[model samples]
Target: MPGQVTLELDPSLFGEREKRVAHSGKLVATAFRYKSGVAGLRVDNGAGTVTLLPFQGQQVWDAVFFGRSLTMKSMFDEPQPTRDYLRTYGALFLHCGGTSMGNPGPTDTHPLHGELPNLPHTDAQLVFGEDEAGAYLDLTGIARDAKAFHHDFVSRPRVRIREGATSLDMAVDVENRAGKPLPFLYLAHINFRPVDGAVLIDSVRDDRADATVRQPHLAQDEDEAVVAYHRAIAADPSSHRTLKAGVPIQPELVQTMKAAGAADGWTHALQRHPNGSGDFVSWRPDDLPYAVRWLTRGPDQDALGLVLPATAAPDGLAAATANRQIVWVAPGAAYRTSFRFGALDPAAANGLEATIKTIRGG
Candidate 1:
């Protein structure tokens, strides 16, 4: 049997339980009050606590072990399109760059640096049974909204626990419930902040064969930034500079990366500090063909809080769909992408080889 746990949201425990989840315990689950009928789930894994608000399972907001530290600056739980929308749809964007309607991307980010459709919208159910079979949350309703009017949206999700494992699964479904067919965009904007003193660890999965980098808009200039970024990367083949600091990928480069892998797809990985106490961010693309790699640097940016976001489509939803960049679905379509947030124990450091073998289960 898995660990037995109970769920509820009691404000009195706010300081005691919620605060401790991020820095003390192995894990804890509690549902906090957000708005009408919408409950936010907070889980602590000692190193940090994660808050997941499942309004109809559309996941309006997600803040990890560090409390709402980052979201407080930009990712607030306001209405989608506007804070007031919360009264109408029970959904909100929580961030500056999310939408309420459309075929939200299957994952987040593309190599070409484009955007996906909207997040999932559907009628989902919450489960509170036992074990894997007892695990709750059925996103079937969201998966079945491909052909109908495509309007009303809801998200139902589940939190599963095992030793040293934390996983979040959710489904977004929208029912037209209106007269006309609904066309929208979806993207998972998963943002995480690295520990205060960590540096970016480059991996083989993020290699660029051509002299051309995938995106350039993120750069200070289109023509000059592209040339300099590529040149810096090329000159530093020995060191890790696949993406030069303080430069953004251009839009055209994003387009090129989209076309190259839209048919097949790719994977991106990052490693946290070798001796640190956190997990790396990983995402997989299911429906969208493209993946974008974004790096933010400046006096304004943090030395530790980096971003590795994934988008299903490139550009905005309108452009992705018009350019046939967005993947379409028949009636009753559903998509899912899974991520593992793993932490290394101090003992695992002493027995690095043994830990590796155990992770491999050999």
Candidate 2:
């Protein structure tokens, strides 16, 4: 069996350096806790470091590639308790939904973005292994959402990063333990900070007809200026490809896109920064048929959510049901999806851009 260690929260170990460095060409994982008592795990893969918050929905809290930060900016300074979702919502990768996601309907009782964000895991472990591909570190956790006589399900989420790599691979296997079939909604809320002059690239059609702007209900009371921005997006979805540093995407701009998959059945989304560097994510379109573009460029928070893969748009449970967009999982059945988030240097970015152009037939 591969070596494994159970995660524990220890404030005394906070900010301690990783004595077992990855200099030997092996992946390293260190567990620590923040001053707020939130548990975290840091994994070093020689080329980059990723912080995982096991106690807080197993979110990828922060990621740094070769001293460059690839995460979004937020008001929160550190991670907070699971109940304080919004207060500690500045993670690089956040897993949303499982049972229910998005804003709740007027009479609905579920919390915002479902019960996954900041939801504590029942148990988590760090497993070290060497495969044909390379040495890798795996962070696995089990979380559950249940209600009496209603629905019960377990989500097993795993995040893996290999040695000498700047990418993280994520997969979630959700099992329905309820007595009957259950409806499911899922979204990978990946938040990548925008770089000035970065151009957005994705596998979605660039035509306005292939996109639909769905204004978030929470932003309905915005001022006229923000409302006009939404109108601009509706009129020309292609405008979303250009990113500026100081623009305002207050509340957010939610656009549902008609995505196309490559010959290998994977969809690609990337932000090619002006310096020739970039951040990208790739996922299987078959598993997540719906692609959403979420951008929030407020004063305090600036994020370019390149591509959000989901079983359905974040239109609340009621709307999804009415539209028959929710995915149904049979009792004792499981649903699985995987994606990769990586940083690219100039050369790699150039090569990827070429490939994307070829795929787009440009």
Residues forming the 10-long window of minimal summed lDDT in candidate 1: 90-99
Predictions in order: lDDT = 0.35, 0.80
Residue-by-residue lDDT tens digits, candidate 2, 147-212: 898789998998988888888999999899998998899999899988888998876656576677
Q: How far is candidate 2 from the true structure (C-alpha RMSD, Å)?
A: 2.9
Leading candidate by lDDT: 2
TM-score, each model?
Answer: 0.51, 0.91
Q: Candidate 1 at residue 40, lDDT?
A: 50
Report the number of clashing residue pairs per model.
65, 0
Error of 2 at 291 (Å): 0.9
